[model samples]
Target: MTEAAARRAPTRAPEQDPGARGGVRRSSVRGQVLDALRAALVDGDLAPGEVYSAPALGERFGVSATPVREAMQQLALEGAVEVVPNRGFRVARRGARELGELAEVRALIEVPVMLRLARSVPAGRWEALRPLAEATVAAAAAGDRARYADADRAFHRALLGLSGNGQLVQVADDLHRRSQWPLVTGPVHARRADLVADAAEHTALLDALVVGDLGVVQSLVREHFAGS
Candidate 1:
C-alpha cells in the first residue's frame, strides 16, 4: 500500500466534513454538506426528534438550501433522518431495541466476511492498516466527537475493505454510520471511556486477523458487537 493510503484516516472521503470551500463542483458541495450533516448528527449537534430546515442548515454551513436539501435526502435514505410532511427533516430516534437489531445486522455481515479475510489475506496486509486504526484511537482519546466518529468509520471501513468486496464495504460503512447517529434523548451514553474502549477494539481485531485463529476471531467479533 502507498504510504499516504496507509496514513489515511479511517473514514472515507465522502464521510468527511471538511467545511465549505470555494469553487467546488455542485456534486462535491452536496457531498460535503451531507458529510457535515452526518457529523452533526453523530456529534449531537442535530438533536433527535428535532426538525431542522434546509435553509437553517445552509446558514450553518454557508451554503444554499438546495445542496442541504440534497444532502438531507441521502441521510433520509440511510434512516438517519426522516422528512417531515410540511417541514424539512427530523433526526431519526432509534431506541435500544433498534440499536440492538442494528448491531446484530452489523455482526451478521461483518463477522463472517472478516473471518474469511483473516484466513485468506496475509497478515502483513492487515498490519498495514494499523496506522488507520491508531488514528482512530487518537481521535477517541482526544474526545473530538466528530473526528472520532469519522476515524471510527474510517477504521472499520478500512478493515472491511481488506475483504476486497467493494459492495460489502459500502453496505457495512452505511450501517456503521447509521449506528453512530445520536439517540433522541439528550446527551450520548457513550462517554470518553466508552469511545476509548471501542477504539481499542480495532487493535484487538487486527491482532486476531494476524493470529488467524478462527475461534479467536469469532469470539472477538461476537464480543465486540455485544459490547457495542
Candidate 2:
C-alpha cells in the first residue's frame, strides 16, 4: 500500500479503550454520586418529601445530569427517593411509625446477635473494634452528621460481621441506613449533643461486650435502638 494511503487508515481507532465507552468511568461517577446523595439524605441536606432536580444536584456535585439521574434511580430503587416523571425526584417521606418499625425490626435481629457475640467472641475482638467506635465519637464531636452516620454504620457493620452471617449483616445494614434518614417532620437535624451521646453508646456497648456483661449489653442495645 502507498505510504499516504497507510497514513489515512486512522490507526484502527486506537483499539477502543474499554473505559472510553463510559462503562468504568461512568459507573465510578455514578457510584460517587450515589454516595453523595445518600450522605445528603443522612445529613438532612435533602429534605424528606422535597423535590430535587437532577440538573440541580449535578450542579451541586459538579457533574453532568446523566450521572445524577442514574444515582437518583438507584436511590429510588432503595426506597430513598421516588420518581416524579418529567419533574425530578422527591425524597421519600418516612414518618415516625415507619422509623419506629425499622428500629424495632433492627432490635429484633441485632439484639440476639450482639448477645451471642458477647458471650462467644473473645474480649480482644471487641477491643479491636474500639477504633471504629472512637471514630464515631470523633465524627460526632465535629458535628458532622454525614461523617458520623458513616462511622456509625461502619461500627455496627463490624460488630455484626463478627456473627459470620453475611445475610444477617446485609439485612441489618439496610435497616441501619434507613433509620439514619431524617424523618418527614420534627428534628430534621440531630443536635451536636445528641450525636455525641449516640456515639458514646458505641463505646459503652463495646465496653459491655468486652467484659461479657450480657445484661448491660442487652440493655444498651435496646436503649440504642429505642433512641435511634
Q: Please give each candidate's TM-score.
A: 0.83, 0.87
Q: Give each model's whole-structure lDDT.
A: 0.77, 0.82
lDDT tens readout by residue for model 2, 129-206? 999999999988887777788899999999999999999999999888888877233452447778899999999999
Question: Cα deviation of 96 in candidate 1 (Å)?
Answer: 0.6
Q: Give the range where candidate 1 is weakest over 10 consecutive residues by summed lDDT.
A: 1-10
* Root-mean-square deviation of Cα positions for candidate 1 versus the true structure, in angstroms: 7.3
| Per-residue lDDT of 203 in model 2 | 96
Among these predictions, the greatest lDDT belongs to 2
Over 4 Å off in model 2, which ranges?
A: 1-22, 183-190
